[model samples]
Target chain A: SQKIEQNSEALNIQEGKTATLTCNYTNYSPAYLQWYRQDPGRGPVFLLLIRENEKEKRKERLKVTFDTTLKQSLFHITASQPADSATYLCALDVGFQKLVFGTGTRLLVSP
Target chain B: GAGVSQTPSNKVTEKGKYVELRCDPISGHTALYWYRQSLGQGPEFLIYFQGTGAADDSGLPNDRFFAVRPEGSVSTLKIQRTERGDSAMYLCASSLASADTQYFGPGTRLTVL
Candidate 1:
């Protein structure tokens, strides 16, 4: 069975520190991967997108790295702030704009 | 600018009853999609529409689930003989076109009792 996995446990880090989240998948080849931030009782907001051919993509304080060979993508938030605390989701384009998303990892940046 | 919006932020229905959830996509968006998300799980695709036609309905769990975009703008997801398992967050999204970034709505929480 195909699966997209992310760390279910909440990650805690002090403010101003860098936070890293991992997304791994099995049995799927995706051309494009996207990251979104979702707050409680709200919809997901787009953050960044990285293509398979590109090794890394960055926007402002957010950066994403994709490794097609490993079927993994890592999301990083530099200079993390308390406002950055939320569930971050990784989604892969399964063709025709259909997205398969991981469970998401909760990040908590405490001050 | 207005974003995608879903109606009845929350809905409670009885088992075996019928329910309808509405989605209003952003203007000029040609693609619309429906998904269901359960607790601790990512949103699962249910259907996709391109210009008022259902281009993909394979994600629908069963015949009981159906969606329509009569004017290629506002959409409605209809569920027949709703079951407890149908209880989940029904999300709607739209994009400028196929393969483009999708903007999602806040979702409609459906509870089947």
Candidate 2:
């Protein structure tokens, strides 16, 4: 069976530091990977997307790295703030306009 | 422009009752999707529609669940004989195309007692 795994269920980081979240998958090769941030009682919002051929993508203080060989993707938030605290999800494009998402990892940035 | 929207922000129904959840996609978006998210879990795909046709319904859990997109704009998800296990947040999303970024709505939280 295909599976997607995040390194941890919850992560706590100090403010002004870099927070890295990891997503690993097995038994699938996706053309693209996406990251989303979701807050309490709300829907998730798109953050960034990286294609298989591209190694890294960045927007402002957010960065994402895709390693196809290892079937892993890393999401990094620099100079993290409490405002960035939320559950982060990784989605794999399963072709034909479908996406399979991992359980997600909750991130907490402490003051 | 307004993003996607879902009706009945919350619904509480008894088991075996029928329910309908509605979704209004963004203007001119050609692709729309439905997903279900449980507590502390990521959204799970239910179905996808392109224009007025259902492009994929593979993720639908069973025959008791169905969705339709009429006139290529609004869609509805219908559930028959709701059960306690059916309780979850029903999400709706829309995109300009299959490969485009999807925007989600506030979601309809369903609770079956």
Candidate 3:
């Protein structure tokens, strides 16, 4: 069975620093990998998407790096702020347009 | 533009009862999907619809769960003989197409007593 894994630990970082999150998957080659931000009592909001063939994608201060050979994707937020605190989810896009999501990592950025 | 929306933010039902959850996707979205999330776990895929047809129903746990997208817009997820184990937040999402980035709704929390 295919599996998606994210760090379960709550990451604590100070404002104005960089926060990095990891997403690892096994037994699947997804066409695209997506990242989302979810707050308490709310649904996930799409953040960024990186194609399988691509190595990196960037938008504003957020960057996503995909390395299919290693079956891992790294999400980085530069100059993080307290407002950026939330659970970050990584979803793999299986070939058939289906998504398999990771349990998610809770991020807390303090001032 | 407004995003996706779901009805009955919270629902409570007794075991063996039937319940229906509704999802209204963003206007003009052609793909709709259903997911269930248990506490401390990732959201699990339940079903997906392409237009008026169900393109994928493989993730549905059993025959008790069924969904329909009539007119390819509004969708309703009906559960029969609900069990205590079926209690979870039912999520709905829609996108331009199956492979596109999906926009999710707040979700309907189902509690089976």
Per-residue lDDT of B2-103 in model 1, one digit per residue for the tens? 999999999999999999999999999999999898987788899999989999999999999999999999999999999999999999999988456889
**If scored against the real structure, what TM-score would every candidate get?**
0.98, 0.98, 0.97
Error of 2 at B55 (Å): 0.6
Worst ten in a row by lDDT for model 1 chain B: B93-102
Q: How big is the positional error of residue B29 in model 3, measured in Å on the Cα after superposition?
A: 0.8
Alpha-carbon error at A61 in model 2, in Å?
A: 0.6
Whole-model lDDT, model 2: 0.94
Which docking category, incorrect, acceptable, medium or high, applies to candidate 2? high
What tens-digit string does per-residue lDDT give for candidate 3 at B16-54? 999999999999999999999987777899999999999
TM-score order, best first, reads 2, 1, 3
Query: Per-residue alpha-carbon lDDT of model 2 for A8-102, expressed as tens digits?
Result: 56899999999999999999899999999999889889999999999999999999999999999999999999999999999999998788999
Clashing pairs in 1: none
| TM-score, A chain, model 3 | 0.98
Return the lDDT, model 3, position B27. 96
Tens-digit lDDT string for candidate 1 (A73-109): 9999999999999999999999987898899999999
- Quick one: ranking by lDDT, best first? 2, 3, 1
Lowest lDDT 10-mer window, candidate 3 chain A? A92-101
lDDT string, candidate 3, A1-111, tens digits = 878999999999999999999999999999999999988878889999999889999999999999999999999999999999999999999866788999999999999
